[model samples]
Target: MGDLVYFLNGRKAEKIEAVTFADLRMQESDIEEILRSSIDMICDDEESMLIVGQQVKNEKNGRSDLTAIDNNGNIVLIEIKRDRKDIEGRKEAFEFQAIRYAASYATLESTEDLVKKVYAPYIEKYRSEFELGVLTSYELLIRKLNEFLRVNKAGKSFNKKQKIVLVASDFDEQTLSAVSWLNSNHVDMSCYKLTPFKVNDEIYLQTEKVLPVTNYEDYYVNLMDKSLATIVKRNKGGTRRTLPKIDSMLDWGVVKEGDVIAVKDRDNEGILLANGNIMVNDKEKSMQSWLKEIYGWSSVQTYVFAIHKESGKSLSQIREEYMTQQAMEASDDF
Candidate 1:
């Protein structure tokens, strides 16, 4: 890592020195506490990851740093360490320790089990931050989990898998190598590097997700840019990305109202309406909802799954053609 510099003026700059947590005399507990309250530091609006509990104890007679449930209802184990020494000095490999903790979550039989075991305590611990009405902590936990699942339309896949996230200021080479192998072998694991910087007496931290997470829901994939649908068989490089909505397709003139769309090999079809909803059985639904239902998944690439009957092509193909044409025209302008 390099220095973090801030420009006070066009010609003047202030260079902030990179510092270790030890340099600032900060304990790993401090980092855990911050992350327990601010998991968003490692996440963005595109994804949802709610930290449910911190220092959660497991049957293994050890306590996990933090636990979260992602939008797709996978319990995420987040373990934090200060540096390379902290990660490698453990009796077990850091990754192995986290994997053991995560394996314990796989035994959860139902969402209710999750509520009773993990989230209920979180509600009580953070009671002041929430508005708990005439309900017990367990009820509040259920409400929170259900509401999160309902809002993201992820109820169907609640707790289907467990994911591990390891955070440390510095990771040893072997740990990263092992994590890479695990991810390739279909283990949902990620490493996030959290570095600290110091300026005068103030210390600041930066977080970055080190490995690109593999797409869990790879039922559909779009090889094109965006705003359309395409389908291909799953392969090793199935990375999930942001997909464009029907509004973008309409803007690009890929498809318009009165057009018919259907999922591959499905006889029943739906009609695209002017308001960007698909009409099925006289009921209107958003393309995302339709796709999710068809795929029976919490996260589905909608545009890829939808086929435009008029063009006999995927909206992905149409959008790809339009982008290519636009790019060619733009080049001719030069």
Candidate 2:
């Protein structure tokens, strides 16, 4: 008879020689190895480009683990845990150890040094499948780390924000709660569960839940949608201010004064006297309301009439001239 037998996923139970659960939990490295092997499945379709190593030591703190880089040259710090033991507690060990590793390589400057130090020994000493894997991982980490550092120095930090990653088989309530709390507080991080299952005596690693990277702030989705829509709108039209400008005009009462606005007509022979005075086409009502808010409507009308009288042209003619001038100026940019 086999040592142990258990129903797996409630599908046609099979009895076989069971590896001791204690043996599985005994060596932390074994669990780490499983995760290291499972990374391909874990990182699939995620921002992660290439995973460098499982337990990358941080030179600065002398204590750290998983480090990776994404396709866009962003750094990802990972921490792995199998289960709880008597030493320092499981979740605590995973969290703090990863944080220490993350802190060591938190900024771009330190990440490069850490990458080299962790990979150099492996690159020099080994010659096998694992060694080749390490080499490939090192190359990825170095390339991205260098590129990320270069971009950071050039003020591209927003696009290269670091991601702290945690991978584990099981997390206790405390660990999950802590993670959720950190996420709520706007920490840039994510957690993944790695599970190993046996089918016909062959072990296979599977990736479970991939947690949200960060918490949702008020109007965050709306703001992101607005930003993407603005970019698309810009590519489509040569003359469209963003939705934000319209928003500001309505919400903040900011007068819509372009640097050199354009109002166009069929004729192109006149000077653009009404260039700076033009606002958005739809803001006339709210703009007039603002004018009334600041000064009376009669004052605004008088001012408008005075501008026309002084220029010796109708408002329409002034606008057409302004648009013609703007058309000429816009062509100069190309």
Candidate 3:
């Protein structure tokens, strides 16, 4: 649980203090919050759902950082790095090292072969349990992913989510951004941003959405001030270019082409999107319903129709056009 609090400068900052996952196990109550938040990012999609952290163990060989058991009962390798050191130099190298560890251990022709070859005293400790759990304060995400693939037999299946997550007080911006960009290309993988905050001298952890939430279409729309498509497109680039038309800009499943979305009435003003989430000046039916159904049609349709005809193109298309026009005028700031 993260809370927002004023710092010495009255600015906000998460209070991690001396907490570090390397010294704590996932089962610890304090680490549970970080695990919950970080796991959300790793399990953002289906492939990631079956893959989890602390399910892997790493040999003391100093070569491998962590190890995990994939769904298929195979081995997955991992490496942890949290330093700002130039030794590793490249992020991809860390990922590749884990792959290499798995590759080496993968030479076993079968489960029996794996037992005879890679399974050491330590690995055998958890062999009967059929899973390994490892945590490094740095980043064990690479292991999380490898373990997921092994557990799920990813390549053999058409499944798409790659489960992996890195938990830290503040991770490297480059790695975070890269992981984010990669996450957008597929739903199988995701990342989470955990900001620890202290409010009234109490530390709380807050979970922020990093990927586009399909269910809360309106909520995200309002939060990001962009249409669902725009949000999805920016994160997950795909060929599904179904932009909405002008009149259907306010219709469900449509983008209004504007960068920002706002809802207003006589008394209060609020911002909105397709998801049922919002930020409003006041909580009122006029405001709540409008925010909840920001892209929906109702009595408001009459006014919209008076301005623009249905034309049989579906409300989505019409709304898209209108939104696009507004979006263009608003610029890309919002």
Candidate 4:
């Protein structure tokens, strides 16, 4: 059956009948409006989520349905599709469109800049309609944006991650398979089905996350982590390394060819390395892998201070000196 059947009180005379978006005269735009106002219906934490932009134009002249940023600074792109009987190839079209938007959004560098441009306009458009007192929506948006930015700056890195969400009345088998494959590979995509029903004058809506089902969410996350770790390890083998530069300031001045260096942490040192190879705790890992293991995210620059057993100076100090020298050399080139 295309509709979900409901019975009242186990065997009551009342019945809840299935309703389509058309029956309610609700368009995709109406659904978008409702979602913009109540995003938490889809995202778990409403307080930490902000609908920054809607109908946002991308670099390729395509407009995205909604753009939001979570407290973690991860950008979320949402696309809405109406699955009507008249529509054909809706699955492929909607999925492909959302993926394209995601690809374009992944290039965004500064979350602050995006907030100022896209979110500012959205707040301005809806400010007068909000009943939340004298504080304009724009002002509140900025306050939330600043708070998120501050917290993210002090904590683990953000703004580099992007997730795509597709909302529709129903998903086809092909679309489900595509989303499943993407989520399995750590692409961070999800599909939510918004089914509508009616019982007399009351209209009820049901939301279900079709992709990466709740029962398997933990398993999926763990699998993705392992897969990422494996990829990092494989890439480490191909990375080029430079000879260890010796500093003469310390008593044990030089870094020996086989000395082990550790990434500092309270419980887990992550990985110990000697001569560009994993020596302890791990089989093959690089600085990037170590950072991912310790911080649960990948950063271009390593945050931990690597220390050599012989030298008193921390790796941070050595890196600072090296950077300073490189800056001086670059000035000469100019």
User: Where does candidate 3 stray beyond 4 Å?
Assistant: 1-41, 45-60, 63-65, 69-99, 105-109, 113-165, 176-192, 199-334
Residue-wise lDDT of candidate 3 within 151-177, one digit each (tens)?
Answer: 345534322112333333333434433
- TM-score of every candidate relative to the true structure: 0.65, 0.46, 0.32, 0.57
Top-TM-score structure, candidate number: 1
lDDT of 1 at 147: 74
lDDT of 4 by residue, 116-137 (tens): 6677787677666434466655
Query: Candidate 2 vs candidate 4: which has greater lDDT?
Result: 4
RMSD of each: 12.4, 22.9, 16.6, 18.4
lDDT of 3 at 302: 16
What's the distance in Å from true for residue 255, model 4? 57
For candidate 3, give the lDDT: 0.36
Which scores higher on TM-score, 1 or 3?
1
- The residue-by-residue lDDT of candidate 2 on 37-112, one tens digit each, is 4444445321223445545545553544555555444566766665433223643455555556666555445554
Question: Is 1 or 4 the stronger prediction by lDDT?
Answer: 1
Q: Write the per-residue lDDT of candidate 1 for residues 1-334, one digit (tens) a residue.
A: 4426463546778766677888778799999987876566665324566677778888868888888887777888999999878887888899999998998889987879888888778777878966668887788778767876775677888888899989998776667657877877889888777888876676777776655445423322234433211211122342333345567778777789889998755676999998889999999998766765664333334555578998888776777788788889999999
Which of 3 and 4 is ahead in TM-score? 4
Best by lDDT: 1
Better of 2 and 3 by TM-score: 2
Which pairs in model 1 have colliding backbones? 229-303, 229-304, 229-316, 230-304
Q: Local error of candidate 4 at 163, Å?
A: 0.5
What order do candidates take by TM-score, descending?
1, 4, 2, 3
